[model samples]
Target: MNSDAAISCPPDVLDGSRALRLACETLDIEADALRAMSQRLDGAFSAVVQRILQLSGRVVVMGMGKSGHVGRKVAATLASTGTPAFFVHPAEASHGDLGMVTAGDLVLALSNSGETDELTGVLPAIKRQGIPLVAMTGGLQSTLAKHADWVLDTRVEREACPLNLAPTASTTAQLAMGDALAVALLDARGFGAEDFARSHPGGALGRRLLTHVRDVMRSGKDLPRVQPEASCVDLMREMSAKGLGCSAIVDAAGTLQGIFTDGDLRRCVEAGVDLRARSAADVMHPRPRTIAADMLAVAAARLMEEYGITSVLVVDAQQHLQGVVHIRDLMRAKVI
Candidate 1:
C-alpha cells in the first residue's frame, strides 16, 4: 500500500494543547515578522514595481538555497497573475542558463544575507547583459544590494527557529514581500478572473469559469421527462430509465409544469396513494428550482447547494424544458 494512502492519527494526540501552543507561537513569530516588514515598505518597493511594469519581457527570478525555493513560488505567482516570470537557479545561471536572460528582461534576486556566493557569482553576467536588477535581501549594504538598480528590504527582527540559525522568520518575510510585489503588480495590470482562468485552464477555477450548463446537461432523449397528464407509473419509468432519481413534468406546449422526485414518491407511498391512479401533475412540486442552459455550471451548483437540491431543471429563456442537470454530472465534470 502507498504510505500516503493510509490515514494516521497524530502520534502525540494526548499532547494536543502543547502542540497547539507551539504551532500558534510559530505562526505568531512569522506573522509579526511580516507585519514589521510591511511597515518598512517605502520608495524602494514603488521603484521595484515601476521597473517590473515597464518591462516587456519576463521577470527572471534567481536565488540560492532557501531563498531559491521562495523565489520559485514568487515567480509562479507573478506568471499566473499576468506579470510573466520564471525562476533560474543561481548555480545554473553561472553555467549556461544565463543566456535565458535578455536585456529586455528584469532580474529579481533573493538572498536573505545578500552575500550568497552562488547568487553573487552571477552578478557580473547580469550586469554585463545590462539586464535591470532588483534585489530582495535583509542586508542593504551587501554586494547583491550594492550592485542592483533597486532593492526591497525583507529584514526580520528574529528567527522563529529556537536556535535562531534556521531561516524561519527571514524566509517568511521574504515570501511575504514577494507576495506583496506580485499583488501590487496584479492590480497595476488590471488582471481579471477570466485572464487568470485562461492561464490556469486545467485547475478547478478554470473549470468554474469556462464550463456552461448546456455543455454538461442531458438534453432531448437523455433528459428524464414526463407529461403533466402522465400517471405515477409512467413518471417512475421515466425517472428509472434516465437514472436521475427525478422526472421533469411539462405541459402540451413543452413548458415546465413541475418536477416529481423520489422523495415525492416516498411521501405518496406513505400516504397510501396508489401509483397507478394519480397523474404526475397531482403529485409533483410546482415552480421547481431551475437554471438557464446558458448559465455557468458552477453557478448552477451554487443554486443547488443553496436550495439543498441534488438536481435542477435546465430551461430556455421562455421557461421551456431544454435539459436536466444533476449534481453528479457537475462533479464528474470537476465543476463542483
Candidate 2:
C-alpha cells in the first residue's frame, strides 16, 4: 500500500526458517522418489544386469541436458566399479563417436522424456551395431523405450522444483538407479577391493589396498632392534632413537624373539624391576603380534587394532626381523 510497507518485507524473499524448510522439502521429495523407484527394481532390473554381465565390451552411456550430466557420473561409477562404462554424448555419437560402440558393447541411454532428439538421433546407429539398448526413461512408450531391448523405468511422481519444471527429482532418481546398477554388477562380478583399487590407484583407497607393510615399514638401520640379551636401558634407547615406541628383541641371528614396548617398560617399573639390571628378553612381551612384510599396510593396521597395540614386528617366514610398522607410519601413509 505504501513505499515503506512495500520495502518492509518482500513476499518472495525467504527467511532462514523458510529457506531451511524449502531445502528439507526438496530432499524429502527426492527421498520419496528414490523409494518409489526402489520398489520398481524387479525382473526388469535383473534383466539389465544379465545383459551387462554377459557383455565382453564396455557399456556406452548417452543422454541429453541434465540427464547427460548424470549419465557421465553413471558411466564413471560403472567404470570404476569394474563394469567398464564410458559416456558418449548423443550428438557426438551421431558423428564419428558412434563407431565407439561395437557389437560386443551395450548402449545405456538416459532420457527422462525418452524422446530427446539428441538421444533418439543416435539410437538407430546403436541398433545397427547390434548393441543391446538399455533405456532409462520416464516414458515407457516413447521412441527410445519402444526401441530399447530393456527398459529401466526411472519415473518419478514430480520434480523437487517448486515450479515442477526442473529435473531435480528425476535426475536424483536416475543417479540412484545408476548406482544400483553399478553395485549390482560389481556384486555379480565378485569385484573385490583389489579390483576397485586397480581402477583408482591415485586415491587413498588404492593406497590402502595396494601398499604392503614392507613399502611403509622402517627396515635396516631405521628399525629399532636389540639383541634378547641387551639391557632394558639399551632397549629404551633404541625405542626413543627410532621413535617407534618399541624395540624389537632379536636373537644373535637377527630372529625376532620378543618386543619391549613403552607399556612393558611401565609395568616393569611398577613391579620394581631395575631397568639397568634386567635384560630386554626378561621384561619383553614374548608373544607379541607380528605381521609379514608382504601383508597389506591396512591389514597391519587391523592387526594392531585387534591386539590393542601401537606397533607390530614385521617378520619373515623364519621369524627374521624385517622392520617395524608403527601406527603412526600408517597414519602418515594415509593407509589407516
Candidate 3:
C-alpha cells in the first residue's frame, strides 16, 4: 500500500471529538503520574539533593534513547539555574567520553527500565573511579540502581501511549523529577533572579537586571537642560535640539530644580500665557520624577509607567542633573 493508504483512518475513527478525547486522556494520565510521584518523595530525594549540593564539580548526566533526550534537558536546566551540569551520552561514554567524568563530579543517569545495556556497561568504570552515582529509574533492584549511591524512583504505572509501549508519562515523570531537583538546588544556593540572569545574559531578564540607567541615559550635550532663569525660547530650543520632548530647569551649580515638557507648554497655551515672556521656572513642573544614574534601566521604565510620564531626569546624591532618560531611550536599548 501507498503511504497515504497505509496510514489513512475511517471518518468516524478520525473525528475531532475522538482526537480531543485522546489528548485529554494523555494529559490526565501524565498529571496523575506526577501527583503520584510527588506523594512518593521520601528521604531518598533529600539525600540526592544533598549529594548534588556537596559536589565540587559539575553534574555529568547520561542515559540512552528517549531517556538521553530527557537527560540533556535536565542537564541544561540544572546548569542554567546554578548547579553546573552537562550531558554525556551513555554510548559515547563507553567508547572514550568517560574521561569527561572527573574526580569531583557527580553522575546522574536516567533509564526508565533501569536496564539499558549501554548505560549499565559503564557503571563499573564510574564506580571504580570513586564517583558518586544517582540513578533516576523505575527498577528498584535493577543493576543500574544497585550500583547507584542514590536512587530517585521514577516508576509510572503505565505509559501515556495507547499501546503502552512508547515512553510518554514515564518521560514526563522523569522531567518533572529533574525540575524538582534543580529547583531544590537553586533554593539551597540562594540563586535569585539576578543570579539566574547572569547565566542568561542575552535573555529578557538579563537585559532588565544587568542594564543600568547610566548605560542608556543621554548625558553631556545630548541632555536637554537650561538654567531656571533662562527664557522660554531657550528651553524650547534645547528641547527641540535634544529631541527629548522635555528640558530640565537647573540652577547655576547644575542642580535640577524642575522640568518643562511639551504637556506643560500646552497647558500654558490653554491658559493664554505668553511663552516668549516666560522664564524656565515660570512654567516648569518642580520636583519632577528623578532616578539615580546607577539604578536599573527597568526601574526607570517603572517610574515612568507609575507616574504616566514619558521622560525622567537622572540625578546625583545632591539632586544635580546628570542626564535625561526618555521613554524612547529605553526602547532603543530594549530595556522597556
Model 2 is weakest, by summed lDDT over 10 consecutive residues, at 7-16
Q: List the residue pairs that clash in candidate 3.
A: none
Error of 1 at 69 (Å): 1.5
Q: Largest lDDT belongs to which candidate?
A: 3
Name the regions of candidate 2 deviating beyond 4 angstroms: 1-13, 267-272, 306-308
- Native-to-model Cα distance after best TM-score fit, residue 130 in candidate 1, in Å: 2.7
**How does each model score on TM-score?**
0.83, 0.87, 0.97
In the range 1-336, model 1's lDDT, one tens digit per residue, is 566655453463478797788789889999998888888889989988988899989999999999999999999999999999999999998889998998799999999999999999999989988999999999999999999999899988788887788999999988888899989999999989988898998998999998999989999899998898898888899999999899999998999999999888889889998878889999999989999988999988998899888899999889899998999999999998
- Compared with the true structure, all predictions reach lDDT values of 0.91, 0.91, 0.94
Q: How accurate locally is residue 253 in candidate 2, as Cα lDDT from 0 to 100?
A: 94
- Top candidate by TM-score: 3
lDDT of 1 at 105: 99
Give the CA lDDT, 0 to 100, for residue 2 in model 3: 86
In model 2, state the lDDT of residue 180.
95
lDDT of 3 at 183: 98
Q: In candidate 3, where is summed lDDT lowest over 10 consecutive residues?
A: 6-15
Q: Please give, for residues 173-281, the per-residue lDDT of candidate 2 as tens digits.
A: 8999999999999999999999999999989999999999989999989999899888877888898999988899888999988888888878887989877888888
User: Residue 82: error of model 3 in Å?
Assistant: 0.4
